[model samples]
Target: MSPVRMYTTQVCPYCLRAKALLKQRGVAAIEEIRVDQDPKQRDAMIALTGRRTVPQIFIGETHVGGCDDLVALDQRGGLAPLLAG
Candidate 1:
């Protein structure tokens, strides 16, 4: 599987949920970027994803959006393949 990367904040429940779901799907390691720790990282996230969301997920190079988007991808059988790549 490719690397899993996420832009997250300390108190975001959605970030926790997204991490859990990814873990459940066998993602052993996640390169978590804590935007809460650094104000500029949040700006980088928005610049990269065009969204001001807590959990901006990326499976390899694919921008998977937030928690709901991750769940939807799994439901539609796209998550695994994306991860596999």
Candidate 2:
């Protein structure tokens, strides 16, 4: 599977849901960047994604976006293939 990375906070429901979904999709390890613990990381996340939100996800180098976007990708049958890479 492609490497999974996520920008997340400690108590965000969307982050939790996103993690759960990724785990269900066979993602064994996630490089979780906790924005809640560092202001610089939060700024970096905003700059990288152009959005201030938890659960900003990436599959490999591809920005897969947030929870809803991830779900939509999975629903569209794109998630599996992307993860396989």
Candidate 3:
């Protein structure tokens, strides 16, 4: 499986939902970067994803975006293939 990484905060519902979905999809591990504890990381997340959202997710090198985007990708049959890589 591709490496899964997510920029998240402590109290983000979207982040939790995203994690649950990824776990259901058989993602065993997730590298979670907490932006709430570190201001620099939040800035880095914005620079990387061009958004100030809580859950900026990355499946390997490809940015999978936030919770809604991830759900859309799965609904469209793209998440499985991407995760396989």
Top candidate when judged by TM-score against the true structure? 3
- Cα RMSD of all models vs. native, in order, equals 0.6, 0.5, 0.4
Q: Which candidate achieves the best lDDT against the true structure? A: 3
- Candidate 2 TM-score, C-alpha based: 0.98
Judging by lDDT, tell me the better candidate of 2 and 3: 3
Q: Candidates ranked by lDDT, best first?
A: 3, 2, 1
CA-lDDT, candidates in order: 0.95, 0.95, 0.97
* Local accuracy of candidate 3 as per-residue lDDT tens digits, 1-85: 9999999998999999999999999999999999999999999999999999879999999999999999999999999999999
lDDT of 2 at 54: 83
What is candidate 3's TM-score against the reference?
A: 0.98
Worst 10 residues of 3 by lDDT: 45-54
User: Residue pairs in steric clash, candidate 2?
Assistant: none
Q: After superposition, how far is residue 21 of candidate 2 from its true place, in Å?
A: 0.7
